[model samples]
Target: MSPPRVETVLIVDDSLVQRLHMVGLLRQCGIHGILEAVDGNQALELLSALDTLPHLIVVDLEMPGMDGVEFILQMMKRNVMAPLVISSNRDLSLICSVENMAQALEIPILAAWKKPLTKQHLAEILHHSPDRPPPSHSTPETHKEASSTGAHELALAISRHQLLPYYQPQIDLKSGTITGVEVLARWPHAEKGFIPPDHFIPLAEKHRLIHDLTLEIAGQAFAQAAHWRRSGVHLTVAVNLSPRLLDLPDFVSEIDALLQQYQLPAEQVIWEVTESSLAADLGIALANLARLRLKGFGLSIDDYGTGFSSMQQLSRIPFTELKIDRSFVHRAHQREHLRVILQSALDMAHKMSLVTVAEGIETLEDWKLLREFGCNLAQGYFIAKPMPGETFTGWVKTQNTRRHGRRGS
Candidate 1:
């Protein structure tokens, strides 16, 4: 086989030791072309001066003068699209805040490492990088004029039925069989092509259009599930629930109506509520959730362990599932502490009689690890990317055939 291509990397840190440590790690990973910057200003200067930007940038959040947030803001302002990996010894909350800020700024972040970075983490980042093209590269900037749409535009898209549901399959780790699929919203604009949900979901919530959007997507998902049932797939469908939707007085009734309309059993549908969303006004959220559970819908605490009072939330709410966030699941194979934490989470979920689903399983190692830890289900790029209903149906058929073939063999 031919030698692997060497990736160009840029490392920015205020400490010489940290910079040198990163250099050593990168070189060990077979990355030869590496650049160093001591601060954010210096990094920006290098970025502006370079004829070709590095494939990846490793940055420190707590710098002497120009901090990581400022550097990320500057990068966003300049429309720099290189993937960033945040490496710091800071607390997890602060690191997560920086990550959330980067996402808000639309900066592509490959991964974040809590300092003392390792070769395994670097290798994992490189392994996942090929699949996630910088957003700019994945989608052309030809429609710059129509790129950023406002709430009015989003409402119009909803009315026009432009927002659609795409399905990502969840697998049973033990059996390696497809179990369920998550419903992710996608907006395919005529001018801009596919618009990511992160771009429009906040706008929808701000404009009171989220309710309509959620219902529309749920309707499509239920319809698809019904079709699959008739075709003998019998797959469960999960849809994310917005906190605002949960607060609506008639939200439970609306869900009931949707299930009744589709003639599908409530047990076949899952309503996923993020832990962060549940942290606000739990009285109402819990009530809605309880009613849904009473009506036979599966309730999952999405992105488990990312928010405050996760244990309290689990104790108070009637959640039937716990989804370990991608951040923890992705790194469990490299970090023993993370692996222990994941194992504990799985143990807790099992003790509570809740199904465990690990998100963002990118490699076979991650899949195998989750199975070893007794996780019930796994989802992410490793199994399949989200696809339209038609494409998902085809994928399900193929998976079934493969399973049968293995049995026959």
Candidate 2:
């Protein structure tokens, strides 16, 4: 078989050595048509001059003038939709901030690597490039000054209902059917488009706004679930709850009201709480959770294995589901240790009569392995990315048709 077709790439960094290093790495990945820029300003100039733009752009975060974040903002302004890869030696949190900013600007990020770039990382980025859709060119109405941690801005976003919930489908491996959708929050800012949860979630938690934000998401999710039910497509909607929310005096009552308002059965809603969240003040958290369970809402321990005292939490919390973390599920098919961990999690869940869900099953191999391990449900990009409610019904239809077609064939 021949190698994959190479695409034109642009490397924007102030250091000559770094540019050369990246160039060599790209070449090793069979990529050519390399373009160079010293800074964001220079990169912008180069982009304007070239008739054919690069398919991918590698950038350094801390350039002297018009840094990576500024460059991405400029690119968004000019409607440049090339995928971006941030190669930096800065702190991981810093790199993540830049990635989130780019995402908010609607830039498609291929990958973000901490400096000392490797050939393997470059190859993986190249391999994944063809499958990624190009960034959208539609511009946000205005561009607000980008802030790394904007807690006040997040409060405003929540009040404005900009913190939208996007649904990601969870599939039943045996039946090949979409069992439900997990409601993941996304901030569709008037200026930044869609800001990810990581950017503002912690801030919300810190400012005691987490409960409000989560309820906002739950309200929207319940509304969508009601819509689907009315349309003859019943789907359980899962929403992650913040540990802080459990401390609220009327948390269960608030959720009960929301369910009643939407006329959605509590059974159709799943509240996913991470194990770490349960580690804090489990006395009250457990009480609140028990009330939710008694109300008929499905409770799940999200990211099952990554937290402290997971088994203890599972035994104490009235959880109906256990979701294995992605770290163990991503390559469980090839690695015996990971497979063992996954199998053990599944076994534990089964013994407890809890439904098992494997998160981040990104490949067919992992999905098959999870099925063989008797995972009751699965969710990840392999199943479907989180999507807007407007398009979710249609996506479910397509998935159902495809599944039926496969079975018939």
Candidate 3:
């Protein structure tokens, strides 16, 4: 009455001798089916041609034409997910982390290793990953597989604290004035032109890289705001809080420390949480929201109507601002009832004494409709898309300058 054995695994490297050694180890470990690839391309080809992708991939950093990094980048684009181990004879250099680059691309990696794959090493990876291959599509994708030297170069950028924040404006309808700005993240990897949040944010989350990334964005935003303060421009900065970060009980306390460290007013900071977040732990969410609000921080529901708990979410959480999701606003005119939906949302918010903000005002018609319907504020392409913090500050100054110019004229 012995248990059934596990399936085979694929080992990708340019060296045949190393592959054979790995095959021997797998056999000893009771993994009978062993597939081999001399390099990333062949490995990928074999993986695609197979009825089922291999149970695991053991990648080598240095390979022929399409190296391990290039292979990983391609793997990310295709969404070919599998637990990966970076096995190389050399040390874990800045470059080897590229295998973990999938985290940034939302591909997950199990572990990286030095050459001469050992049984104990296999045991360690298997202990945690006995049932399923680690979800490679999780955050902080293997860095070793991103681009030529991209693994090392990207590491340098992050370690050197070069990641920066850009800002998108949120308007105020009551005074017809520029209000706060949402702090959007930006990293100009020398090789990867304007790395999108879709590419990096999730990776940061998957690998727990979000901790550092979040701190960096918070610090940078505060510094940018302090600079504008000297120039007489003060704007509230809103940063999106992911469910991963919010789940931690200390999340609010951490923000408290950040505010004190940066000498920024709690009133000057706004935190945006999605509807999905409100549902995760309703009790925790309400308690944290109340704590943040008590400390003078602003809280808003982002993409409000999209989540399943719209009614319950609003009722349970006392959010200061209700954001009408862009999806509803975009189709409001067509569905006609959608306009009614927007009106109902507004009515509900007002009944609760919560300010309503309309997002994604892309067209003049949408703008006119929202303003006409008493939506408290409008923000989207029509107002302006997110931009660099400096650019936004300058825009604010320029607008004031123009208003002054008109008065004098």
TM-score to true structure, per model: 0.81, 0.70, 0.61
Writing each residue's lDDT as its tens digit, candidate 3 over 289-388 gives 8889999988888888878888877776657888888867863553465688888888888888887889877666777777778888878877777888
Candidate 2, backbone clash total: 0
Clashing pairs in 2: none
Q: What are the lDDT scores of the predictions, listed in order?
A: 0.86, 0.84, 0.75
Predicted candidate 2 versus true structure: per-residue lDDT over 62-175, tens digit per residue: 999888888988888898888889989898667866876887676788777789889876776777675533433434432334345388888887888878889999999888
Clashing pairs in 1: none
| Candidate 1, position 375, lDDT | 95
Residues 319-353 of candidate 1: C-alpha lDDT, one tens digit per residue: 99999998789756866767888999999999999
TM-score of 3: 0.61
**Model 2, runs deviating above 4 Å:** 1-29, 32-125, 129-149, 407-409
Off by over 4 Å in 3: 1-156, 278-285, 406-409
Name the candidate, 1 or 2, with the larger lDDT value.
1
